[model samples]
Target: MRDTMKPCQHTLSDDVVYKDVVVVGNGPSGMVTSFVLAGNVPYLKDIPEDLPIDEMLRARLSNLPPGQSLYDADLLELAEGLEGRSQNPISLLMDNLLRPCADLGIQADSLIEWRYDVEKEIDHVVLGRGPPGGAWHTFPPQVRTLSPGAWLSLPPHTTDSAERLTASAVAEYCRRYVQACHLQRYFRCNVVVTSVTAAPPGTGAPCSPACPRSASYCVSGYDHKEGRGFRYACRRVVIAAGACDRPNVLPEHISHHALHQLAALEKAAQLNQQHPKSQSRCWWWVRGVSAADAVRLARASGLHVYHLHRTAADSLAKLPLLNYPDYNQVYKMMCDGASGNYTNYKSLPEHMIVEVTPLLSPQTTNTEEENKIRLKKVKLLNLVTNKTVELTVYIVAVLIGSKPDLFFLQTNFDLNTIEIKKCKCNEKKIDEKQCFLRNHWHYLKSVLGQSIQSCKSRYLNYTEINGNIDTKCALPDCNKRDTCTCNTKAERGLAVRECKCEIIPYSNLRREKNCQCQPTNPYSSGLGYGIDPKKPVDGRSNPVAIDKSTHEMFNFPGMYALGPLTADNFIRFIPGGALALVTHIHREMKSE
Candidate 1:
């Protein structure tokens, strides 16, 4: 409710609101419901194939017009355009948006390509992961997870809540097959949502409040000079708001991470000096480390200082995910635990309740550009009993959730209405002994070894762990305490995983000092620093806004991500509170 934040439209009204069903977000879940209903229902017939969808990435339409042919043709072209390229589009259209509406009996127009602008359109910027930074949608977090469903958020919860799975598919369907399709009917491009008022019935037009109904969708309106504002009002609103469409909002605790690492490194130094040179080999042999991975490593090592067994990718570099320290340690930990009985399901530890899937994310997913991965919930499968149970997730689905004016009958003020708090992602622990943020470059330097250098004097430094780090250390805390997130500058934040408000830290083998602080981006623009550098800046080495990781989007046979994105039996996603939603539609005849 700060002036800096935009007023969300999903707030609750004073009246006791009632409807057939009040689906909050317009993302996959809501869209599937509506795409299933749209023209099939008795009243709203001839529903245009051109349902207005938000642009997932900045893209452009070569030719814009009306009707199904153009849409389909353009979509084909777009898909073909992306044939060999591997990048995650901001929005992914689902086939459910095109599925035959069970009631109205109309075939939905599923997206098959990138329909919206890739580089031109501007999304209303907000953190879609972590939590609901003040948003509302059709389903609650619980309903989403239990159904084996998926979602995405930037900062965490945008409980103006909703679904992501189906819609993401449709976004792709349209983009790949509906390019010049007939989108002229349902909406106007660039109509960013500006305001929403869910007052009592008869509050305005028939589509307005007095009716006590909500809107289907409200996006930025359009104007020639200044862009138009948002729109509202829809009977039986089929919201498309999802939890995975928010922007990046990095944690502001680089400092805390440093200190945590410093403590961890100090212990490692003791081990390095005592251990033999052969034992001083780098941590795991994995090659690339992503921002999300670092964060994950940090979370798992909270309090208990967990060391990086090595640095490398789970696949290409020859390291196995199951064999990695974090993976093996967790697997070992899972092995020791007894098979969880169904009768005692409610008492499961928070971590075992996780379920994972391939979906977009909001964390520092910047490192593996060619390896764009999507996340779903983590499910706990009892290795002993072969029984699989759904685990709640702490997801950062905000990036995929926030959109304007869907499920607008409420304004979040009504206390009786379910209070949708902005769930935040987790952050790091600032323990005095190990300040990773203070020694980020130091630890990194240690890991990188010859490939990297160390931070200057007074700054933190990274050193090799040797065999000493792999085993135990002599630190007072190490002797007395359990674990921690070592040199990896990963920490907890506003949203732990899915939007649960809890700031905690992960254990990365809590270290003492050192890192890769040798200036990755120290070049001064248009000046002396550019004299010696010869690398092209168009981004051979520079950071590209869009990640170009492998074609890990659709799970096509030779194209699935080597790891992370794959949900094949071995994965698990966990969270706090999640549920499954069941919907049934009934048609109302106008003649009545």
Candidate 2:
């Protein structure tokens, strides 16, 4: 028993390594914190005497010249050629650092020991499997930052140009920053942190005599590639795993029996395809679906699509109409398809789906079987008609939109820690939900108005300046003051067409008399889009609340949360927030 105990103790001691800080995520917040600590923090800049030399030597060689060595030069040349075409951050960093080295004649062989000491500056560990740039890695190629390019600059690293950057470019920039600073060795990618607990009282003591404060946490995680569990004893832990790490799937108030009928309809469609002469018909009732997806679905199903939208005009102007050729095709398709079956509702429906208050027959009880039977022929209330119309719908596709991934927070943290409660009625009579809805409706109205304004400007330019008038605008002479009048007049030897343009008043579209929710700051308000009701009113909720000044968790000492994990969701704010936290951490360490 004594021999076995000794072996277990030895194994446990060998498994755990001590560090000054442990960042639990590899996203923007974690990467920036790690970068700052490694590069700027004075106390953490201690190089251990027994630090690994081989890893440092390899890192330095990748960023230095081969000098007169043929073998090294060839290897470096090959690496540079491959790296030029590579999007990998490390590769880009190596290229950036090494390009100047060859011209300067800085040899790799002579800098082995010097690089080793430089690599050992910071004693921190970043644990996560996410790409080096964190959530930016998952961003679509065309996804642009809300702020201008200059606002996204991290300390000691600036963007290539002072223009708005796409997600891919921003992510690459983050990678380059990491590589340029030589902070790659500190990252433990593919490491998933399972649990973080307070270290045992005595075990919390500093691993090194020089460390002012004792270690506070024992972080345990599993490595994907290694297929083994690892542990770390660290003085501080930063939780920057990101708020959207988990998906927030709200509770479905409706029963599954209604949704199941959709599947039955799909099966019937498949079987109908086998028999062409069948009189059976399948129609799609699309509501709140994107124009692109709706067209694709309609084309694929070959069904008469009834597109119900809450707008006066059918326009793809508000949608994400980027420069992609496929998107352009989709826009054209949507415009052509709208004339066939699009119903632009002046006002939103009271309820998308109406429940059958009582069973169809008096004999039927509210049983599951009876409910399914009743739901088959449910009544849909028409907001315009103020009447209920009964229909036998084979399937219903509900595509509202997506919410933040908050599943991780839900499973790990308590409800109050992450749950955002619905707004309460106050004496001021402000309906929070209604306020959000009105703001969104107004924003959409503004976008539509802008589109119409652009069209009017082009029409004026063609008629007055170019002397070319649209055939649609060429009409018989009418009174100049008439609202429906369209007449062509000569101006400076050019044909000038005068037409009364009728545009929907933005005020009429907005329901709320007064909108208290105005954008005081672009950084805090986010994009003018309406906030999802399922999300916290403030935005995404973090698992741990932290001090704004220190970025340290309120409940747990030496623990911090940053980036999207906090209130700020924009990329522009991340660098500044991270810098503050890093600065606070350094100050605390220095004081101790």
Most accurate candidate by TM-score: 2
Candidate 2, residues 155-214, lDDT tens digits: the string is 444433435667789889878877887779888888766556666565344333234235
User: What is the C-alpha lDDT profile of model 1 across 1-592, one tens digit per residue?
Assistant: 0112233344334423333223333222332222212221111113343534323211333243333322122232332232111122111111112221212333333222222322211111111111221122212221112111212321011112223233233344323221233222222222222222232354433332223244332222223335322233333332223322221221212111121222222233333345344122221101122221322332323312112122222332332443344433333332333342321111222222223443335457443321221223334445446667652222221110011111111122212221222211222333643554434755865643212211121022112111011111112222222333222111110001122122223245542221111111111110011111222111111211211222121211111111011111110111000000111112121211
Index of the highest-lDDT prediction: 2
Assess every candidate by TM-score: 0.25, 0.45
- Off-target runs (Cα >4 Å) in candidate 1 are 1-26, 40-171, 177-184, 187-195, 199-226, 245-586, 589-592
Superposed on all Cα atoms, the candidates' RMSDs to the truth, in angstroms, are 23.8, 22.7
Query: Model 2, which residues run further than 4 Å from truth?
Result: 1-12, 41-121, 140-148, 160-165, 203-213, 253-544
At residue 574, candidate 2 shows an lDDT of 57
